[model samples]
Target: MAEWALIFKTAIALFAIVNPIGVIPIFISATDGWPAKDRAHTANTVAITVFIVLTVSALLGESILEFFSISIPSFQVGGGILVMLIAISMMHGKQSTTRQTPEEAQETAERNVIAVVPLSIPLLAGPGAISSMIITAQQSGSFWGHISLALPIAVVCLAIWLALRLSMHIAQRLGTIGINVVTRLMGLILAAMAVEFIAHGISGLFPSLAS
Candidate 1:
C-alpha cells in the first residue's frame, strides 16, 4: 500500500512538473502546417525521447552523483531550487529559460527536426524533471523501486503524447487564457512540492533539524 501511494505521488509530481497541457501551445506552433500524420509522428517521437531520458536519469542518476562525490541531500536542495524556478515561470504563464533559452528556441524554429532537439530534450524533459527523477530514484532505494519509477514516467509521457496529438482541439476548447489558468494551477502544486523537496533535503543534510 505504501509503495502504491508513493507511485501515485510520483505520478502527480511528474505530471505537475511536465505540465503537458501547458506545452500544447508550443507544440501546436512548432508543428504548424505539418501534415496530421507528421504531427502525430512528432508527438510519438517526443514521448519516446522523454521516457528514455527520464528513465535513464532515474536509473543512473545516483551513480552520476556518486561519481562526482555529491550527496543526495545536496542534489535535492539544488534540484528543489531549479524546480521552484520553473514553478514560478509556469505561474507567470511563461517557459523557464532554464528549460530552453532564447537561442535554443530560435534554433528549434530554424531546425527541420525539432522532435528530439528542443521539444523532447529541454522543453519537456528538462533539468528540473531529470533532477526530480534522480531524487525520487535515490529515495526509492531498492532495484525494484528504481524500476517502478518508469511507470510514472511512462504515464507522464503518454499524457504528453496525447496532449500533442490533440493539440488543436485542446487549443480550441481551452484557448490561451484557459491554458494559462491550468498552468498556474499546476505551478502552485509544483511550488508546494518544491518546498517539500527543499525541506526534506535540508533535514537530510542536518539531522538535528529533523528532530
Candidate 2:
C-alpha cells in the first residue's frame, strides 16, 4: 500500500461513515437521561463497535463479496445509493435511521444500552458504513495493504470516541439546536460524499465517458 493513499482512503471512509458532526444529536438524545458513568460506557461502546466492524471487514469482507460475485465498482455504486438515502433521511428527519426513529427515543427511555444498539450499530455503522468498509476491503487486495490501512482506521475511531466524549460539554452550551445544526451540516457533507462515490463507480463502469 502507498502509505499516504491508505491513510487518505481510511480517513475518507471513516469520515463518511462515522460522521462525528452528524452524531452530535444522536449522542445527545441517547445519553440525555444517563448518569456520567453510563454515558462514558456508551461512548466506549461506540468506539469499540467501530474497531470491531472495521476489523471484521478487513479480515472477511473481500471473501464474502467474492462469494456473491459482487464486483467492487458495482458495490460502490450500490453503497452510494444506500448512503444517499441515509443522507436524505437525516436532512429531513426520516424514521428509518436510528437518529430519526421515534423508537430511538423510546429505547432511550426504556433502556441504558442506547449507544450499543441503535446509536453505534445502525446510526453509526449502518448499511452505508458496512458496505463502504467491505468495498474498501475488497479493493485492498494484499495483506500489506490491508494492514497498512488498519492503523488509520483505529485512529479515526479514537477521534470519534473523543468527539462523543466531548459532546456533553458542547451540548451544555449549544443544546439541542446546536446538535441539530451539526447534524444538518454533516448531512450536506454526506450527500456530497455520496455523489462522489456514485461518480467514481460510474467512471469505473464507463471509462470512455471522460473521453
- Candidate with top TM-score is 1
- Candidate 1: worst-modelled 10 consecutive residues by lDDT: 104-113
The alpha-carbon deviation from the true structure for residue 151 of candidate 2, after best TM-score superposition, in angstroms, is 2.6
lDDT tens digits by residue: candidate 1, 52-167: 99999999999999999999999999999999999999999988889988887777778777899888989899998999999999988899999999999999999999999999
Tell me the tens digit of each residue's lDDT in model 2 across 1-211. Answer: 3667756866765675567656766687767777888877888989898778776877787778789998767877998888787777757644335334666556655765677677777667767777767666656677776776677678877877887888877767777676566566656667787887788788788889856
Per-model clash counts, in order, read 0, 0
TM-score of predicted model 1? 0.97
**Candidate 2 to truth, TM:** 0.79
Reference-based lDDT, residue 72, model 1:
96
Clash list (residue pairs), candidate 2: none
**Model 1 bad stretches (over 4 Å):** none
